[model samples]
Target: MNGSYNLSSGTHYGSIGTATCVTGYEIHGTANIMCDNNGYWNGSFPDCIPVDCGSAQTIENGNVSSTGATFGHTATYYCMPGFQLVGPNLLTCNASSEWEPYEPNCQGMYPYAIRK
Candidate 1:
């Protein structure tokens, strides 16, 4: 849904191409397709499924705000009063089905860093 796909050659009887999802998305079906002798694609058209990074973990002394875990979605972490956030505070689902910049942790304002 994020982008479009292209074929390597003409849509002839023996043409072939690779179906790939754009960045921040993923393919849920076959990546390779071939034009068959019957003037049809060998397989069903692939679907560009949104990448899922799953749910964010609970952070001590902090709160997480996420629209959704699917691709193109964002998750932001914020520390409560008297606390600070460590690592990247924002994470976005990427095409590889992972969160960008990794997940962050929260720590007390006046103590050693705590990872959660």
Candidate 2:
């Protein structure tokens, strides 16, 4: 269960003003969740941007997914062996209501980019 969040307005108390914007997933077994400001009452931190998973894609472990500005967000992804993840390894809901930036890369290797 790995996740990342951005601190937004508030004093870490239970209220609309206090919320942490989450930008990652909390995958627990068959359940995949994205944290939002809803955690305030539960004493969970919120993020700057509301975590909204628009679509789902499947990818194996050791893969790379990239996206452009058309995609609302860009993410780095990874998976486990034997099992596969169903969703963009790195994804963002695009302006056209499309999960951009990519279709998902499958393989076991290093994901790096060379500066030209």
Each candidate structure's TM-score, on Cα atoms with residue i matched to residue i, is 0.72, 0.27
lDDT of 1: 0.81
Number of the predicted model whose TM-score against the real structure is largest: 1
Candidate 2 C-alpha lDDT tens digits along 37-88: 5553343343233234454454545554545332266655666664454546
Question: How high is the CA lDDT of each candidate model?
Answer: 0.81, 0.45
lDDT of 2 at 88: 61
What stretches of model 2 exceed 4 Å from their correct place? 1-54, 62-76, 81-89, 109-116
For model 1, residues 5-112, the per-residue Cα lDDT tens digits are: 577698899998778777777778777888899998887678887778898666888999998988878899999998878899988877777888787887777876
Backbone atom clashes (below 3 Å) for every candidate: 0, 8
The window of 10 residues in a row where model 1 has the poorest summed lDDT is: 1-10
Angstrom error at residue 79, model 1: 2.2
